[model samples]
Target: MRVEYINPFVEAAYNILREVMHGEIKRGELYLKSTSMPVLGVAAIIGLAGDVQGRVLVDMTKDTAIKVASTMLEGMEMEPLTHLNDMGKATITELANMITGQAVTKLHNLGFKFDLTPPAIFTGDNMEIADTGVEALIVPMILEHGKIEINVAIRERN
Candidate 1:
């Protein structure tokens, strides 16, 4: 894994988690996982092109996701958030899109230009959302606030 390839993600995550998620993330950490998830949660995937060729996935459980989503929507429960529902999917997808959008600008500022495909939302407990042929660098970010965790996965283009 390349540090150059990964640092931007950390930068982006910290910014988004702080600015949008109502999360006060620390310096933040990144990880790679080859294991299968018990559930897919909400996967907001933005395809990559140009300087960086990879997809970024912001995934989370329904409950944890609702908490973050509601927080983003001004600290109110969504009223009817259920497992993998459309509301949950939209919430997570938008969050991922916002992060990626900011990342694009940051990358541009740093002298790299990358284009993103539209963010896609997937909802399922047992579905797999991996780019079959791309090498992935999973960046699992953790947020703390009376016990909450938010994980993000990023993989370069296939």
Candidate 2:
């Protein structure tokens, strides 16, 4: 993905994390991945369409999910998230939705148009995805609680 295509997602994630979790987000160096790698534990996958065609995977560990969910739930106490609970799933999915919605708006301002599908939350140990014929740009961000990977696998629509 071009920096033009990728920056909005990065910026949106950064902004959303800070607002939702109320924590400083540290971003790592961006890298390209040729193959899909194992996700930490939970992933909220949101599909992108219109000008860009692909998916964005917000990947994080179970602990991270619980912590983020708890924060979004107004600091509700949470145990180790063993499975994808409703509140946990809703929080993560909404994070993905907010990130994509904001990014799409930014893209619109830049003369690009796009639409997003609702997010789908998936949970499992070492969960991996198959490459969708497009290389993904992995943007890793660290929060106070855990790490979140914003995997962007988008290309200009043909």
lDDT of 1: 0.62
- RMSD of candidate 1 to true structure, Å: 3.8
| Per-model TM against the reference | 0.73, 0.91
User: Please, what's the RMSD in Å of model 2?
Assistant: 2.3
Candidate 2 residue spans exceeding 4 A from truth: 75-84
Q: Tens digits of per-residue lDDT for model 1 on 1-158?
A: 44554666666777778776554566534455555543445566777788556667776665677666666656444364434456666777887887778767776787777888988876667666544444455555666532222333444434
Candidate 1: which stretches are off by over 4 Å?
23-28, 34-39, 75-87, 144-158
Worst 10 residues of 2 by lDDT: 75-84
What digit string (tens of lDDT, one per residue) describes model 2 on residues 10-62? 89988888888876889989899977689888999999898778989999998
| Residue-pair clashes per candidate | 3, 0
Q: After the best TM-score superposition of candidate 1, give how far the Cα of residue 44 lies from its true spot, in angstroms.
A: 0.8
Query: How much is the lDDT of residue 125 in candidate 2?
Result: 85
